[model samples]
Target: MKIPERYQPKNNKSFASYWQPTKDNLLPFLLPKTNISDSEKLVPYYFKVDDLADEVAVEYFTNTPFNQAIAKLHTDFSLFPSNKNRLSLATQNLFQQLNEVPSWVDFDLVNLGTSYCNRTGTAALSVLRNYCLMGGYESSAINKPLIFTQALHKGAVKRLADTVDFWMYVTEINGLKPNNKGIYAVLTTRLIHAYSRIQIEKKSEWKSELWGRPINLWDMLATNLGFSIAFIDGLSKLKFKPTAKELEAVLHLWKYVGYLMGIPLHLLPNTGEEAAKQLFLWSKSQKGIDTDSKQLAWALYDEPLRVTFTKNKIMKWFVQKTNLGYNEVLLGTESRQELALPYSKAKYWILFLNKINEYFDTKAKSNPDYYNKIAKQGRKAQEKVWKLYQQAK
Candidate 1:
């Protein structure tokens, strides 16, 4: 698909030349017309057709007997034996949609990306936990249903499981392939989001202007960008810089993942730089923060800490302190003020620790044993987070 003229980068400049790492670039994009109605609405210009396609898929899954079996499996995996026929039928019906792996995907690049994620370790977790969570809350489209249902607080374990499954897919071998655990998890999430959209749209209180359809294409793109572009930016702020090649591999990994998750090809950028620009454009198009944004942001910020650290005050304090610093730096002043996060001396300490870790990481990259050790540490941390999710449940 040809890129839209408006969406194309200005002057046809390469993203590296077009993007500047400065305060101006970090600031949110401003829409040209401030007073226009629906300024806050994130209409999927590039992917409207794809959105329609997804809607059809959702309708089929929701109305079919296959969905019943899927739900049963969710409740008890042991029931899979009884539902084998239904599961087979459902898998066959969804095969073409779920089986596709983009022709452009490079397994080597995916492995490179996975390695980079492993190397970054806890720094990546900080970004996923704080920065991405903050972005989700900032979006009125995402925040409303979450806030209205109190899902972040009440369904914390299920929510965390979904997140863990996502990371495992991106980081695991052959994760994006059809019938793999990662791909299956991704498909299930797509169905769940589609189901949520259908259920939420039926409510009288669900405002189309603010909420859009649940999991609209635009919102999905924004969420994907958070994990890719915004995530890398967050890591950079923490002084953990990936090589340009490593960064590109990370983008490549997520681009394919986005494709599997039903985001259109036109909307998925080939490079991290373009992804950043896309995020900025999407952010500028949205309306200012609302009550729902604030409520949801605060709840997400507090709930995970409360749930995970309940037994150890010292551990909770340390995580909270580091998290606060990371969120402040990544979210920037505007988001911090909007979310009402307080300024802290801990930010200075956080940066210092990041620089110290970066030095060690740089040295460790040359030593295979050290590299393997950190990778194991990173995996262990992920397992701990998964355990926390289970405990929270």
Candidate 2:
């Protein structure tokens, strides 16, 4: 079939249209109006997007009256310069414990050997990416009290609840229901689980740096970004209906991850060691890495980047976990439980989605009828989740 001229992609819209434009499309259109010829020079044209920030409450949340109250709480309390200064001081004191090696070994070089430190850096990158993706304003107006609250909140449930509240506010503002309980709940749960894993891993490895101390940075930053990437990519495939805001949030989060890893944000189709080169840039950007360390990490992490990772790898991993989860009743595993499901309706519908994608992969088949059937089911589920979320507010 010959493609219609209007329908054919003339520029980057080809890709943007494929994904369906959310807010990012606004900037590109506004560019020509600003009279900027150079795309790189057009970054400043985005001032309008950045200038429009305001703090608005959802006015309807029953469980949490304030929209993004938890995130706000975290920003206000824990992440302030005072708090960070203290954290840096602690880190500095912690740094002092490492045995004094010859100038050849170097003090800052110790973090490279510390898996824990690397992981913390990655986790910090993940959270930073998440906020950036959500367009968290880099504002002096950001409440320091909230920052402290988020960091100091010890219970995983409380922290997760805060994140849910932020998501809820986002959904309400965009006129979408918080549909897809299973995906959201599971994503949060797994992140916390990853956190626990980091802590345990760090505890086991904690050694004296020069005296052979185990490193603890893994629990700090890298764990969240690394683990969550796999989870988000999987969820994106199985998702039946995600609001534009939600989708934007996810994409932005991924872009930020790429940036911190030293990957250029424009890398398309998101695959291969070529992709990992960006992340390796992040790791090596730390002063003093010899050529050998950089090469080894890249070589080790490469298998996860192959195209097969998207097909068999993500599908296989996510499907197995979905089956093992509370929503597995939708998969015809356990009988549907009576407990109030967070995203009960979408949970069941998402299964059909999994199946359709699987058929396309394992059989190399495209069944339009089947895709339509799954999409219809998803629409119904989305309606249910959306209403439920709004009603709760």
Candidate 3:
């Protein structure tokens, strides 16, 4: 990686300034079941990783206690390598890039994305786990790092907890600003990914030519798309309609988050059309599911059963099946089969529940009190979900 145009900011204006989900521009948010017609391609991004982090991680991990330091850095971003080290000037450069705000950032839009997350509450969580994260497993090439890191053995609850925490932090209003928890989360995650890439590349089993880097730029951008477009699409399935402006703001929010996380922002998508095309090509890179795929997917598939949110045996069963149904509905039949997730009658029942909620949501959204009440309900449910996972044995 030659570090192409490092700190290359996205050139698009704010969501409200230029783009709207008009008929000509309103490409459906759904991930298409067939191949998309697009000139852009995904193969090249596979050759890229976070060059700045890659350099810092290599020097730091090679010099320090690898596992212990990686663990400590989760709570302390200051442990990241600095300018004093003689090997390279990556840290001084990295901080400079982080501090320089891109011309495109709009804090109001960022906060809108956060508001959307909080308003939908547990539905956002469900959509993320079932649609975005679980759906990610079908592309077997991406799971190498998780397997290498013993993610399945450590359990899905642990993995999901970390993921959930990161989402919660970054979506908070003004969370991505310097010295904030959101910034801290991105810093910790970026280095952790870099650490994994280093460790995985050293293994005899990893074929760099076939899979690209362990967590290449392609995969990293795809993860960002998962949070941005895929997340919005998943919420749509639940009949939660965000305005055109709101939709674009969600993508805009993740664009900045991706920036802070050291993803090569030049390749990050700012609109629905761009995101759809990028994701379609990236998904094309998958070969098929294997044992490791099933092992990893199973971790999340059974996670609801382990959550200690409710002592009522019947309610727990309902929650478990609803989770399975959610996977079935959002992931489509093919992905459910690929993941080997069990069938549940609750899939249709779940759809019916959404229809009823949508009716109320449509009416309530016009009134501030009603919408705030819905958001409160959503926040409460999200808290329960997070607490149960935290308390899970």
Which prediction has the highest lDDT against the true structure? 3
1-393 per-residue lDDT for model 2 (tens digits) = 221111111232111111222332222221112211222321221121100001111111124534354344334323334454543343222122121122332212222112111112222222222222111111111111122233323332233234434333222211111123322332232233333323332453322221111111211122223323322322333322223333344333333322222222344113222222322222222222222322322221231222222356765444333333313322112111111112234345445655663453332114545444544443344445334333333
Residues 1-393, model 1: lDDT tens digits: 332222322332212211335532331221122332332233544324244434544545565676674565343323334444655444443445556555788988886777777777667777787777765565554556675555755654456556866786667756766567776677667766665666666778866544455566776887788777777776666666667777798888888878877787788888755676577666554554567677666665565456643688777667667777777667665677677666666778777777786785686566778876776777677667666665665
Find the 10 residues in a row with the least total lDDT in model 2.
48-57
lDDT of 3 by residue, 1-393 (tens): 322221111331111101223322222533344352231255556667888888877766776896676654443345433423533567657655555678889988888777777788788999888877887887677777898888988888888888887887897768887667888778778888998888888889877665667888878988998898878877777877777777878989999988888787777877777776666555543555667888888888877666655668777788778888888777666668767878888898778878875875585478878776776677677877777666663
Q: In candidate 2, how many clashes are counted?
A: 46
| Candidate 2: segments with Cα more than 4 A from true spot | 1-229, 232-365, 368-373, 379-393
Candidates 1 and 2 compared by TM-score, better number: 1
Put the candidates in TM-score order, highest first: 3, 1, 2
**Reference-based TM-score of each model:** 0.78, 0.25, 0.83
Clashing pairs in 3: none
- What would you estimate as the lDDT of candidate 3? 0.72
The positional error of residue 147 in candidate 1, measured at the CA in angstroms, is 3.1
